[model samples]
Target: MPPHDHHHPILATQGLSHRFKPSGRGLHDITLSIPRGQFVVLAGPNGSGKSTLLRHFNGLLTPRAGTVWLDGVPVAADPARARRMVGLVFQDAESQIVGETVRDDIAFGPENLCWSCDAVDAAVRAAMDQLGLTHLADESPHLLSGGERRRLAIAGVLAMGPEVVMLDEPFANLDYPGIREVLRQVVAMHGQGRTILLAAHDLEKVVGHAQRLIIMDKGRIAADGPVVDVLPLVEQYDVRLPCQARLGMSVTSWLN
Candidate 1:
């Protein structure tokens, strides 16, 4: 189906660009509008600035020249407020774990926002229960399996209850089951109306799940549109499209 006429965007980047070294792989003139309740994937090969760009949406990194907006308000205008609305889950679970126990770690986000004890406790229980990690609530993150840690890291974000969730390579080193577990949690979240923005080098999981696709090359917005418009970027850039999407291509009218 084509996009409906919704005017409000939960996340928008205007002419966003960044560079570490001139002409190196960094974002440039990248503009995007992600509407609420949509699952969008930022797809590209490695070094495409997908992670860097993901950082901008949540205020971890601000554009040197352009603007990042959240819910119609420029993100730079109020970094604190913007951060509260958006949650960024880094690809590595080790990068996110900080507390001594799972429960405490999951409570970190809400606690940082000064949430009340009762609210934080309720959030901790609800997030753990939602992810089926209620039993791991007291264990150290180091003791967790890679898949469990990934889920726990995300649970930390869920405890905060942000409006938009940005995942940077959620399945980076996952085995088959770990990948499936991550995908299942993401899909479940999507069903509940949370805006999902994923940066996946592994595009297979995104083929049928993401409603919008953005392909970045070097630092530029190479392509932006529905999956129908952007899927060929895989071939154009000599990258492989997921098998499912490729299979659909033979009879998929919307594809090129």
Candidate 2:
């Protein structure tokens, strides 16, 4: 069974806001709760602050005004603990992999956590098997396909044993099969009860895969609700909806 409400608060935000330079370009008055084990998607147009909002969950971007909580720990004051439990995977796969070899890349996180050699090896192996990357264990990460590279990046975070995984546009450079493969890994992780916060544009890829949706417009949350409630807004917002959702809306009338 999937994890339910009893798991406690994995990530939460209160009156959160962000600004860029002299001009503010992110969300404001943002109060949200991401219960443990929820698969949440951040969606909006090109200029939306979806990515900026996600950064607060793990303290990648500091809280602009209010507060951010992760695993019940305040993120604004001391971000280290939350950072360990809430891992972030950037949109670009190449930018994250620091090491040349896949083994080195996978071991990087544990090494940062100061794990012993034996423990690091075990963590890497477990992460590889979990993400179905045991075969690419010794190869160079730069040589892997886009999807494989994504898995590798995620594997590095898993080595840290984080409770929440934040992915920013994970489907950016993937082919159809690669998209399917990466989505499968994400679904599997969510199934295993790890909280997932995804910022994505390829709505089709994340439509059926996500459980919750947070829609942003002009740096503010336009709508936030269960996937069933918010997904149909694609057309209402004059934005593109997933193919399946658009069809459902057209046929079901009530969805509109």
Candidate 3:
């Protein structure tokens, strides 16, 4: 009802909780805030509620008992707006490819948002160019390599022009080169001043790229702070410290 506060955290959750009907293995009383344009790495063991927390960001999943806010407004108040503001790239790249070709895939979101045809085309072109997919615009997504497919998935999300990008286990199942490719794109996106929340079981690949590190355990935030501060606590919560960190060395970007 009032004017929007531009200074609000890009994403915030208050007492967020969700439970899988029978398993009871979901987020619990999780509370956090991610400042605009900050890159954060979320790490935890399998089933530590990392993915569930990410789902709450873009209205992909409703919290059983809590509130999600996007830009100081409750997500439930305008789910479509929340979704548009926060783009999520799933772990499985194949599952996101619905269009017959790369261009079609990238244009899907903007088209659904009812953007003009010209606008959609422009957005698709920009997204493709940013991710080095312009040459493959006409190619089939199914025909691309693992890294290309992942980049295609990200391009699709980027076309929508989300202010916040959330990636769930993006490096999962990706080979060395695939991981590096995706990592570069992720870093570039953050450099362009978009908020980044990446959840990973293996922090070795992305920890260095993040300014903050959050470790989740049993659906609760076990630790949260600057990467240099929270990183040392990861191993205490079952997350392995990055190889370099384990050796008492500074963490460096995978891109290096």
Candidate 4:
């Protein structure tokens, strides 16, 4: 892993709040700071505002009551710049796949940035290699397996070269092997010094990889701290505590 920079937060939220019409399914008074190169996991049950909060990080959802800052600049000031700095991969990878081929999909972001042909090609190749998708470069994204599609979605975001990457429910709908593959890629990204923020309900799948674990309940932050210290109480907030933690064993691997 690269050196950590403690000077300023890469992403910060100050009393951030939002609400959806009729249902009001959104975040409330969320205040937090994520430093550069930190692998953070935002865990919670369904409807806990994990997705909503992740959207706010990149201006996908506007803050109805508070503010979000990206590298000390308000996200509201320049939503486009903030989005460029932070990339989000939705839980349903198929929803984000636009191009017919995997290579074309991965190249979309860089193309939009108006990168030179060589630069776009380089980025696409690098991202595909990173996600183990080079073999499937010519395949149709829609025809890929669940895990392959998920990796393609992540590769698309990585091609844009964002500083921070947020994935919402990345492990959902995947088999054990698929889960492991995604977990491995996530760890590799963190090793490259990219700040990682993944939201998921399955703590056992990612708690071992996270430096900090945050629990959310009813669209609010319930707990935030080191994974070890906070894992014990995760069950109290309706999120499951890793079985190993409950059995008095160390959480050393997600595969376990």
User: Given candidate 3, what's the lDDT at residue 185?
Assistant: 96
lDDT of 4 at 216: 96
After superposition, which runs of candidate 1 have C-alpha atoms over 4 Å from their true positions? 1-7, 22-24, 248-256
Candidate 4: list runs displaced more than 4 Å: 1-6
- Model 4: per-residue lDDT, tens digit, 36-68? 989999988899999999888898778998899
Report the Cα lDDT for candidate 3.
0.92
lDDT by candidate, in order shown:
0.83, 0.81, 0.92, 0.90
Highest lDDT against the true fold, candidate: 3
lDDT of 2 by residue, 26-112 (tens): 778788888888899888877788888877877888976888887666887777777778889989989999978888898999899
TM-score of each: 0.91, 0.91, 0.97, 0.96
- Using TM-score, rank the candidates from best to worst: 3, 4, 1, 2
Candidate order (lDDT): 3, 4, 1, 2
Q: For model 3, give the 10-residue run with minimal summed lDDT.
A: 1-10
Model 3 agreement with the true structure over 108-148: per-residue lDDT tens digits: 99999999999999999999999999999999998999999
Question: Which scores higher on TM-score, 2 or 3?
Answer: 3
List clashing residue pairs in candidate 4.
none
lDDT of 1 by residue, 109-208 (tens): 9999898999999999999998889999889999999999999999999888888889999989888787778788888888888899999876776557
Per-prediction CA RMSD (Å) = 4.6, 4.1, 2.1, 2.0
